[model samples]
Target: MTKPIQGFSKLTKEEKIDWIVSNYTHDAESAKIILKRYWNDDEALQNLHDEFIENTITNYYLPLGIAPNFLINGKLYAIPMAIEESSVVAAAGKAAKFWLDRGGFKTTILGTEKIGQVHFMFSGDADKLKSFINSVETKLRSEASDITKNMEKRGGGISKIELRDKTADLDNYYQLHCTFETLDAMGANFINSCLERFAKTFKQEALHFSEFDETEKNIEIVMSILSNYVPNCLVRAEVSCPIDELADNDTDANEFAKKMIQAIEIAKAEPHRAVTHNKGIMNGIDAVILATGNDFRAVEAGAHAYAAKDGKYTSLTDASIENGIFKFWIEIPLAVGTVGGLTSLHPLVKLALEILQKPSAQELMQIVAVAGLAQNFAAVRSLVTTGIQEGHMKMHLLNILNQLGANETEKATLTEHFKKNSATHSAVVEAFENLRKGI
Candidate 1:
């Protein structure tokens, strides 16, 4: 067993790597070589990466690919995606091209409200607590004015704050539920700062309230934090065309539309299926989110929660064919920002935003939603027609070839061979060996 070391974080980068490999790795030299291999050649750039987090190691890289031909709201965009998955970018591109001539994706911003709370415990008269809150509401806003001034100047600030009595759920538990308009920023820090200020002001005011007794005056503030679940921050994206335009070389127009609707219905009905179904949608959303330096984890949490908002887990998308028109759409909660966090620091993130044409937060929400919808559309079209594995495994062929250590000639030959046959692992291995043997 490896022993824990003190002041490990205080060690120099080289010393930290030396210690880690000496204790934990079987081949210390190989481990050290691999770690340093990923370091940025530019010393200043490597230093910038090291400062992004604590106990820094060599940077991890993901391929940044472009999925062009996204026509959202009558504007063309070549979306950038950073993901490790093989077929995601290709699928998104294919979806975009399919809709490019069909009026493309249309998006709407339904709302942009975010939430935070100051949870506290109060064991006093409920009416008195309400009166105390009502009295100090203005004080709470005024105290946090310094923090909200810049946001207010940008047409976004504290929207509303309300006191809620939750004694029925937990003993003497209460909350100062607050909502905000953060505009182009995700505003986690802003919301949290405002919440802490509110908690401090509320606690101070409680001590001076004439009607409050000792227990009520000593209100124990549990925590002040922003919620990742922003159900009100929502956008909707949809694509539609005449049923005849939905046809392809292999799939009938009317049958394809009906099958697409049926697949969505199945996902809406079954949790097991819905999980995978929504995961396909996230494949696109998360790719763009990561590329653009947004919080994919936060977006993922809020999106799944919204899917289950109606008491059950279901599909995030819907489809229908009515009066000869095929339509599909997705309305999802995505709280993303364009001006903060990695958007300003990471070089690739800056490039990604520039590729997106420097969209505002609401516009970014719409684009993200459309990415998800387009991805799902591509996946479902495959599932109902040629089957998903056909395209997915075809894209995955390169991975398999690389893993098998195929030479350039062998890889090229096998790739062409698989185009005329199946790219199964065993089949590729056999073909690769035979090719190497000149058979």
Candidate 2:
């Protein structure tokens, strides 16, 4: 572990995140060390290092602020987020505050299941190969059964198998998608391991097909990959608030609702806008994923794909106002977990989970879904009222001041000047030395 920096405890939350970023190396191992201290988990410290090397994927950190004053299902939560965008945190805070003024958010979960794919390729007869594989369906299930035997005792296991045809390849290839009920655990790793173990059976079955002699016909097994297309296991939440609570300084309740709806429509109409719109929701989702050391990338890819599932890119959140009440709904493919792997080991993740009081996997997903809904509320409010850039530019000025190395007094002066003169980086830098000298 790196030496603990002095004065860390005295810094504000934003400053602490910035300090960690400035001093810590941006790597999985380094993240594990820092998180371990935060969560007090030594095992997570070891596993993070292992997973980083095994996955061969790089880590990117972002500062996503957690808003306070959240009351969901009559429970208060200090939500964590991992995103780089500006308005998300402030917007969520405002939206939550508005809801709190009314009755706060009420949420629920559906269920959780992830898809695993197993592919088989044949050079000779596709029919024979498909038949051969189908004949051993029971045996195949048995092979996959061992992996989930424990899960079965817990009332979760492989639920079904699906087949698809592809004629574009030179050789006939078949794709088998296996769906499993993962309960509270994100079962990607388990599903992949199960399919890999069953590959030998699939290969053995292919060799026995009558159309292709084992010696002559080339039968190869392609990919045994885990998919994020979680159509089965989905969680949803709906929040309602009195329109009077959403009223702003100049806008009436009805006017605010109409403007929010219009802004959301704009986001739904354009792909570029939709990307940012969905990203706002993920800001809330990814933070929890990171805190638990779950696969954030898989969750991200699944969410965006689910967003575009209807062939038109759009926002993940929907809102409507009726009978003097405003309602918001959000549905995302959130394949996260509370137990196993990094969740049990990573320190900061553990700390985050503890701060959250170790919610069940379903409970955790519910929190994330609510966070997404709150974040969307924030974004739409900004777009409808003062314009998104207004709040964003104000916060960005701090980053600009840091880049210019202005002292505390200089920073305050520069912030005021930039607020008045439309602060540009070059303009700030030009006056930076003079302002520092005066300080």
Per-prediction CA RMSD (Å): 1.0, 8.3
Clashing residue pairs, backbone N/CA/C < 3 A, model 2: 35-348, 39-347, 44-345, 44-346
Best by TM-score: 1
Model 2: lDDT to the true structure = 0.73
> What TM-scores do the predictions have?
0.98, 0.79
Residues 15-54 of candidate 2 have per-residue lDDT tens digits of: 6555666566577456645644543235555446545443
lDDT of 1: 0.94
- Residue 314 of model 2 has an lDDT of 88
Per-residue lDDT of candidate 1, residues 253-358 (tens digit)? 9889889999999999999999999999999999999999999999999999999999999999999888889989999999999998988999999999999999
lDDT of each: 0.94, 0.73
> In candidate 2, how many clashes are counted?
4
Backbone clash tally (model 1): 0
Q: What is the lDDT of residue 399 in candidate 1?
A: 93
